[model samples]
Target chain A: MTGDEACAEGALAAGCKFFGGYPITPATEIAEHIAKRLPQVGGVFIQMEDEIAAMASVLGASWAGVKSMTATSGPGFSLMLENIGLGICTETPCVVVNVQRAGPSTGLPTLGAQSDMMQARWGSHGHYEIIALSPSSPQEIFYQTITAFNLSEMYRLPVLIMTDEIIGHMSERVVIPEASEIQLFNRIKPEEKSMPYWPYIPGADGVSPMAVAGEGYRFHITGLTHDEKGYPVMSAEAHVHMVERITEKIKRNISHIIDTEGYYLEDAEIVVVSYGVSSRTSLSAVYEARSMGIKAGLLRLKTVWPFPEAILRTLASRVKGFVTVEINLGQIHLEVQRCVGGNVPTFFVGHAGGTIIPPEHVLSVLKDAF
Target chain B: MSIQSDQSDQQTHPLDDLLRKDRIPHIWCPGCGIGTAFSACLYAIKSSKLDLDHVSMVSGIGCSGRGAGYINLDSFHTTHGRAIPFATGLKLANPDLTVVVFSGDGDLFAIGGNHFIHAARRNMDLTVICVNNLNYGMTGGQVAATTPHLAKTTTTPAGNPETPFNLPLLAYASGATYVARWTILHTRDLTESIGEAIQKKGFSFIEVLAPCPVNYGRRNKLKPLDVLRIYQEKSIIKHFASPSELHLDLEKGITLGKFVDQDKPTWLDMYYKTTRKKS
Candidate 1:
């Protein structure tokens, strides 16, 4: 199966009943596949006007008590930021897949880039924690789409699957397990009926049970700084309480949310940190470094935001030097440096939009570090 | 008579009480028609007979977009110009619910113009109430797509250099099943039109010509009452007008009334039928 097909199947397995999006390059295949598949499974597929409307439609579908998703590229991702912020504020559970393409402004719609890593975190204005996953292969995208839906439902936040054009368009054999083999997470619903249910009240797990519209539970939700009752109360205290709760819900649950793959970290002198398509290249570099008898290891980040900072710190302490590989010009390297805390020397191997960092470049960085 | 008696007997209308009281010192200076237009919307919602719990009001960023947050339903204060698509998804997922989109001239017809046309073209089961204030009131009175020709606004200090759009005509052409235009002065008629639009099954667009007292009103040297008087005198019902006659004159403002009434299979109806047949 192709990566796009894998993503669509993953959404179906996760019980996504609604898919609304406008087709853009690299990501168009996801929308096309879902459009064909959704109706067969008693679901809906709506082709909206633009990326802005596409994102808004997904949010609406989610509120109607269905798992909803949309797919897009860099330009479409830029258009979706406003409504993505609304999803965060409203605590609507939905999945957004950015099959990233090269761009400052439509630089290369057909080519691949990992330029949206930072944007996925900060694109939506205001302070909030976002969950973003990076998949290295078609199989990973399929599995990660399920994880994205689970995380979105559990945390009541928008989950982003950030795939570059290369991975999104790549064809590979993917094994989709039977429905009985896959685990699905549904939104926690309130048990008591006609009771005053506060949509923003978090339980012990830092997740609030969701109540859909027409469920007969009266609840208010606002974009402004809101209290537990979901009513907007503008004050320093309310702002502090609301912002802290929103951020802390994800922050406190980092242990359960963060996922990373570490290779050859024991007694390593140098480490290579990368994610998404870059991880594949970085893995190749690690293999080359090992053959050259270099004490080098690799850390592949699966979950990008709520970034694997603590694990990076532990790896940084064990290694003498670190190298960051990415398809963009030194974006995640800053985060690597912040985590390393100047204790170890860090090097960057990066390419701008429409270019991919070769494995040799990463190997050269490992050699230079040694 | 059933609708009339229901309208009269209802005391403490839930929809009316849900509106913002502080803004009740409304920004529209006295005589501006927006208040009358807004009241019509409230009346229409009250008469829809749909469960408030099953209704979701969505608005884009504008003076009118603020209407979503002020309403008592499950409201969404979304981004600027994206209400149509948002409402589209909401209605598709839960066809039983009533979805209403409220947006201003600039927000709906300008930035959100693509969404508006496509939503109409798809014939989605949603109610879209576009309040044409002639200018972008929230952004300090810039000329909008619905601004009349030679109209004085902040952006068009002398006169609007570009041609304006006839929103109901555009919507009617785009395949909206029910399309209507009414000025704020025609309160009872506008309310009745809104009620009928709400009762209609497919995509319904009601373009209300609301007055902006602080912006367009002051610039045109017209009070809200003068704006209402202009609408009352110049406007003609679409059914009453000749097909060859243009709705608007450059000197005198355009006529307003229900322009299109057709039956088309809505997006939701088609979606369900297709899914059910497959099952």
Candidate 2:
């Protein structure tokens, strides 16, 4: 199966009962596959009028007590930013898949790039934390999408699956476990015995238990800075409290959320850091450098946001230097440099992004870092 | 005749249970008509006799968009101009829930016009109530899509050059199963119409003409009473009137009543019938 189809299958495995989407390149197959499969499982698949409506519908479905998602590329992702912010403020849980293609605007719709990594972190126009995962292949994307949904439900915020055109279109064998074997997480519902539910009071985890529409909860929710009762509060103090709780929830859960895989790091001197498709290239280069006795290793990032900074900071003390390889011009590289805090030099091998970064380029960077 | 009968100490308001009294006093101006129109909507919900536990309301940003926040049900105040699509998702996900999109004219037509027409065309099961005050009331009466030609607004100080949309005609053309128009002064009729629409299936729309006296009326040289007087003197109730003929003309005559009420399969009905057949 292709990565897009695997993404849909993963959503189904995660108990996503609703999908609202509009067609965009590199991501449309996720919608197409789910549209055909949802009906069989008593789920809903709505092709909304546009990307904006698609995102709004997803949020609404989530509040209706259904796990929902949507898929889009650069242009559609831009249209979805406002409502994504709404989801964040209201603390609605859903998934957004951005099968990234090359673009400042319509640059290359059919081609692959890691250019949207920064946008996924800071796209939605606010001071809040988000969870994003990048997968290198079809099998990885399938697993990562399910993980994305679980994190979204656990944190009560939207989670992003940031796969690029290459990963989305590539075909590979995806291992699907039995439904009973796949772990699933659901949003915490308010206790029915609790009369007059206050919908925004955080528990010990800094996540408020959600109350869905109907079931006589009669709770109110809005995109405004709201009180514990979900009533709008326009004061600056209210805004501070609301923003802090949402941001702190993710910040405190960093050890549980950030995922990275280390390769050939035993007594290595040169460390190459990459994610998504670029990580595949970096792995190949690491193998080639080790064959040549260059003592190079790979640090593959599976979860991009929250950036695995602590691990990188620890590695800085042991490694000689770092090489950050990506398809875009030094996005994650800036984070890599910041994490080392100028203790060690960091080199970047990338471009404005139309084609993939070749292994040879990473090998040359690895040789240079040596 | 009976001051004790109206005493707050002796009797509670019938709609108090449905209201969030702590959030009030509301932000509407002294003469603004949203209160009356909103009250009629609340009464309609009461008279519809549907399960209140299964009812939910959604609103976009505007003066009337505050309806969802004020209601004591499962309500959502969503982003500006996206209430219809949001409500569509809610209804589709949980067919048992009765979803209503209550918002203002500018929110329903200008920024949100595409969502409204598409929802109507698809015959999505929803009750959409639009309060048309002829301008963006919450934003200090900027010019709106429903603003009359040659009328004054902050954005249209030189007079509006664009002609207003005949909202009933638009709703009817967009394939709404039930379409109606009423003024805030016709509280009983509006309430009855809303109640009927809520009980009926498919996409139902009710456009309520109301006054934005502080922002719009002052700029247009009409007081709140003047607008009500025009609604009283010039409005004609003609059931099953052609929606195209129903336009707002204060100097001439304004047409009001139920324009279109037909039977059609809602989106969910077709979705189930077709998908079950395929599977």
Candidate maximizing lDDT: 2
User: Please, what is the whole-model Cα lDDT of each candidate in the order they appear?
Assistant: 0.84, 0.92
| Per-residue C-alpha lDDT of model 1 across residues A61-112, encoded as one tens digit per residue | 8888999999999999999999899899888999999999888988899999
* Per-residue lDDT over B182-230 for candidate 2, one digit per residue giving the tens place of the 0 to 100 score: 9999889999999988988999999999999999999999999999999
The runs of at least 3 residues in candidate 2 whose Cα sits more than 4 Å from the true structure, single-residue gaps closed, are B1-11
In model 2 chain B, the worst 10-residue window by lDDT is: B2-11
Q: lDDT by residue for model 1 over B59-154, one digit each (tens)?
A: 887788767766656777677888888888888898888888877888898999999999899899888998888888877788989777888998
> In candidate 2, which residue pairs get closer than 3 Å at backbone N, Cα or C atoms, i.e. clash?
none
Candidate 2 lDDT over A235-292, as tens digits, reads: 9999999999999999998999999999988788989999998999889999999999
DockQ of each: 0.54, 0.85
- Using all chains and alpha carbons, the TM-scores for the candidates as numbered come to 0.92, 0.98
